[model samples]
Each structure stands twice: as C-alpha cells, then as structure tokens.
Target: MAVALLVALTAWAFIFYVNMIDEVHDSIDDGLDNSKLLIIHQANLDSTVLAKQSFDEGNYAIRKIEGHHALNHYDVYKDTLMYMENEDDLEPVRLLTTVFEASENEFYQLKVISSMVEEDDLIEDLFYSLLWLYLILIVTILAINTVVLRSMWKPFFKFLNHLSEFKLGKNEQVQLLKSNVAEFKLLNKVIADVLESNIRSFHNQKQLIENASHELQTPLAIALNKLQLLAENPELSEEVVNEVFQTIETLQRLTRLNKSLLLLSKIENKQFLNEETIDFNDLIKSLLLDFKELIEFKELEVIFKKEDDLKVKMNPELARILITNLIKNAIRHNFNKGKIELLITNSSFQISNSGSDKELDSTKVFQRFQKESTDQSSTGLGLAIAKSIVDISGYRIEYAYSNSMHQFTVKFD
Candidate 1:
C-alpha cells in the first residue's frame, strides 16, 4: 500500500505539471495573435509605415523584413532566456514570432514575449499542497483500518486462551464460543462439539476401570486364602502341593497387574490433584532405603550423587510413584552384580544403571504390558505408570542408553 501511494503521488504530480505548463503556453499564444492584429490596425488608422523598433516595456518587437524572406510567413513560438536590467540575470520567457503584410510589397515580423517565472512559482506551490493532501488522506485511512482489524480479531485470541487452559476433569462445563463472524462462529462450534464428546468418553472409560478393579479385589483375596489352606494340608500329595503353589503365584501376579492397571488409569484420569512441596533428594533416598533388601539380593552397587537440593511441587503420591518406578526399574533391569548411579540436581533426577549392550525400544517403553525381556516378575506396567504420573504433573521424562547403562531422566519444571 505504501508503494502504491508513492506511485500515485508521482503520476499525479507529473500530469498536473504538464497540464499547467500547456495552459500557460496557450494563454501566451492567444495574446501574441491579438497583438499582431492590433499593430496592423493602428498602422492603417494613422496611414504610417511600420518601423523596426522594440517597445520600451521590453515586451514586444516589430522588425521590417525583406519581402523575399517574408514569403514563407510561418508563425512559430519558442521558450528562451532574456536579460532583464533590474534583475541583472537571464530569465525564462515565451517568445512568439509572426509575420504580416503591413503595406504593398512590404512585410512586418512581430515578436511577443512573456516572463515564465510567475508560472513556475504558482506550479511549485500547487504541487506541494496536493502532495500534502494526498499523504494525509492515505495515513488517516491506514490508521483507521488498523484499529478496526484489531477489534475484529479479538474473539479469536480469546478462544485461543481458553483452549490453552482447558484440562480433563476440570469441573467447569465447556464454554460456548460466541462471535458474530461466520467463520469464527463455525470454528467455535466444531471445537465445542469435539471436546464434549471426548469428555463423555473419558468419564465412561474411567468408571468401567474403577468398577472392574474394585470388584476383582475381593475374589482375588479369597482365592489366595483358599490356595494357602490347600498348601498347609498334610494329606495332599507332593505334586498337588507344588501345583497349588504355582497357581497361587499366578494369582498373585494377577493381583499386582490389577493394582498397576488401576493406578495407571487413575493417573491418566487426573484423579490425584494434591500438591505439596517435596525435597526430591530426600524422597529418592527414602525410596532407595525401601528397596535396600532387593538391591542387596541383586548384589548391585548403588551410588547417589547430589549437586543441589532438588525441591519440586507435585502430588505426594505421584511424586513418590515416579521416583519409585524409576529406581525399581533400574534395579530390575540391571546386569547381575552391576552398578546403579543416581544423580540429583536443582531441577532434575536421573538414574543410570548397567544393562544390556542394546538400547531399549523407546517408542514401546511407556506402553502398558511392554517389556524389554521376558522378566516374569514384572507386570511390565512400571514405566507406563511412571510416565502417566509425569505427564499429569506437567513434567518431562526421557530415556536413553549409553555407556552400557540404561538411563531414565525426569525434569521438573
């Protein structure tokens, strides 16, 4: 738009200058023609011959020309510079030359002149005035359009803010997007419908998981009790007792799996809303102590390195789960008699443990029931549960394998 305005201004100025100059030339030519007729009429009235002389006013000249040269009798006008006595300098002027027969066998050539200084001054003034007017008009229009556009897009920014703050399990109902613009209104409607459908589906899934996990707990306990009684019976055969023990172990695994699934569901559903300031170093130390027996059984070496006090805000249960899963995973997957390294900083916790030569599958590591090896002891939902907690807490977790060690890092922000 600015470029266009500049071009328009230049074109208009050029055209205006050309037209004004033409008008000034035309007026001068008309006066010259009239003066030639007047000079002839005056000569005829007094019956006197026209003489070659210049007027004292320095505006016109009469020159008696030879008849042979005057035969062509062509009239012409030109711009020229002439010296003026008062100014002591040559100034621009328009000169018109015309020849007429003043008497028999005689020709008179008349030259009429006019100063162009006044015309140039007038044109300069006119050009500046038009330029300013055009600039003012363009600037005013641009400013007004800027204000109008900002107001028009206000609703879109509002909708974006609301979407950023939206969360599952938020008690507030979805706010209907309202706007007068057709496109914006349509967008709002689509977003509202999609969110509503998703919320309903999430609630239904959460209810089903809660009901199934809760309902299975009672029967699982009774089965374990019955298996225990059968194992204590002295009359039972040795083979039968062994089979019952194996059955009991399978049921125990099922119970652990059930609990993990329920915990994962709860984390994903955002049920843990509690927040407390936790010293991550202390929590990690406490969790390591709880796993001291398992660590000893694995014959693994544990090292804790702290550079700063690692304090963070999150639900106490979730925080505990995140750290516990990380440390326990390290222990469960480590090489026999290998080493485990724990590092704590102001904003992060990292655990590196000796493991297999190959890296774990990062894509499937966070998925439920995904495991790196056939480790029957693990329900294979440990990392998945930890990831759910990290996600709901608005923290980040990363996994990597380097230096023959499996590394898991959690960033609290």
Candidate 2:
C-alpha cells in the first residue's frame, strides 16, 4: 500500500511541477509581449538610439538586417544557454525574436532575453515540499492502521485461542462471550450448538451403559446362581447333572457375550475416564497363572519371557480385559499340545500360538466376530474387544501367521 501510494504521489508531483514551471514561463511570456509593444513605440520615436543600444538585464535589442530576411521572419521563443561574466557555468535564458519596422522604414529583427535560473529554483522547491508532504502522510496513515486494526481484532484473537484448546471430554462446559460483530456472533452460536449436541450424545450413551449393567446383567446373574444350586442336588441323575451343567455353561457364555458387547460400547463412548498407574508385567503373570489349568488340560508348551516391569497409566480394569482377551484368543485357537509363547519387553508385548498353516485375513481379523478357526467354544469377539481397548488406550495391535503359528503383537509407548 505504501509503495503504490508513493508511486502515484510521485507521478502526480512530477506532472504538477512541470505544469507550474510552464505557468511561470507563460506569465513571463505575457510580460515579454508587453515589453515588445513598448520597444516598438520607443524605436519609432528614437530609432537611432534604440538600434544602437546593446541588450542587458532583461532588455531588448534591434539588429539591422536585409529586407529578404525580414520577409522570412516569424515570432518565436526558445530556451538557450549562454556564458555570463558573473557565473562560471553557462546560464539558461529564454529568447524571443520577431521582425519589426523602425521610424525611418528600415527593417530590423527584435530579440528579447529573459533569465530562467529563478524559475528552475522555484520548481526544485515545489518538488521537495510535495515529497515531504507525501512521506509525512504515509507515516501517519501506517501508524493509525497498526493501532486501530490491532485493537479491533483483539476480541477475535481471544475467542480463537480458547476455541483451539477446547476439550469436549472435560467436565467443564464451553463458555463464550457474545460478540457485537455479526460474523463473530454467527461463529460463536454455531460452535455452541455443536458442543451442546456432543454433550447430549455423551449423556445418552452413558445412560444406556448404566441401564444395561443394572437391568440386564442383574437378572442373568440370579439365573446363573439358581442353575448352579440346581446342579448340586443329590437326587439328580448323571445325565440330568450333565444337562444342568450344559445349561449353566450356555447361560454363562450368554452372560459373557452380553458383557463384552456392553464393554465395547462403553469403551467407544469414552465412559471409563478414571486412570491409575499399573504394572503390565505383573498383570500378564497373573493372567497366565489364572489360565494354567487350561494350558495343562491341553498339554500345551507355555513359554514366557519378559525383560522388566512395564508401568503404564491407564484404567486398570480396561487394561486387564485387553490382555485377557489376547491370551484367551491364543488359547482357544491352539491345538492340543500346541506351543504358546509370551514375549514382553519395555516397548512391546507379543503372543504367539500354534495353529493351522493357512493365514487369516489381516483386515478382517480385528473386526467383530471375524475368524478363521472352527472352534465351538470361541466367542469371536475377543480380538474385537482387544482392538477397542487398544484404540481407547492409545496403543497399537498387530496380527500375523507364519510357520503354522498365529501371532498377535501389542505395542505400548
């Protein structure tokens, strides 16, 4: 802006300076015309003296010439350079020439000279004055724009800073001041609406999880307890006892599947907000110990390796469920006397088990109910639950199969 304005002002100043100089010359020429008339009158009255006089100090001169030269004469004015006794360099002057007739009828050419040094000085002064004015105006406008524009945008900058750091999961509600500016007012209203809708959705999901835990799981628990008591009856036959046990197992499986689905929903909805410091190494050892009976029944080779304790800040319940699912999936998919391996390090946890030689699809493996094994006892939701926990806890899980071995790796950072 400054450069463009300066350029425009400079061009205008140059044109104005030129016009002013031309106006000055025009005024000088008018004076010269008046002098021309007076000289003609003086020559008519005192021709000999007027013709004999030399030009000096804005004066006139009459030079005698042939009649043919007088016929060819025309009035003309021009600027010329001439050396003067008072100045070392050649000085500029304006010259006017025209043919005239004296009292004796003799032809002569009248020439007029006018000094232009003062006109040049005047133009220089005008240019400097205009340039100074342009500079002063430019500086003043810039200072005004900086102060005024910054003050006007202060409210907007404040709103932007708060909005960028806004957290939806936090207990605190978003608060924004109403703005007088139309655009800013619109922005604030739109943001408020979106945040309100998100809060509403979060509350709805929380209510659903709470209801399922209370209303559904409670009745299922009672039924399982009743089934257990019925199975313990002394009068029951062997077949009756077996049937009772099968019914209890089916109820238990149903209960677990319901619980897993509810847990997946809760994790996705961000319901487990509490966090605590837990040692993953200790957790893994305890899970392995819990499943020792299953490993023994299958005559599986269990290998465990870990470097040191891995401490992480997370929801203890969710972490336990995540690791439990991984271990359970490895066990359910393995063959009798299968080789099971657990490798734990500071950065990662890996679990591998002996299975079929064919590889499972990696894309479908993490999805719910996705499977390659035909095991009847497997729920197929184990990997999905593990994946949900991994996502919510901000960890990564990967799966691979090679050399008739299925492997699942969990990375914790």
- Best by TM-score, which number? 1
Residue pairs in candidate 1 whose N, alpha carbon or C atoms collide under 3 angstroms: none
- In candidate 1, stretches whose alpha carbon ends up further than 4 angstroms from where it belongs are 1-116, 174-184, 215-222, 265-278, 313-315, 357-368, 391-395
> What global local distance difference test value does model 2 have?
0.82
Tell me, by lDDT, which candidate is best. Answer: 1
Q: Cα miss at 283, model 2 (Å)?
A: 3.8
lDDT tens string, model 1, 194-255?
A: 88888888788878887988799889999999999989999999999999999998999999
Clashes of 2: 0
Model 2 per-residue lDDT tens digits across residues 210-243? 8988898999899999989998999999999999
Model 2 steric clash pairs: none
Question: Which residue ranges in model 2 land beyond 4 Å of their true spot?
Answer: 1-172, 233-240, 276-279, 296-313, 343-347, 402-404
Error of 1 at 198 (Å): 2.6
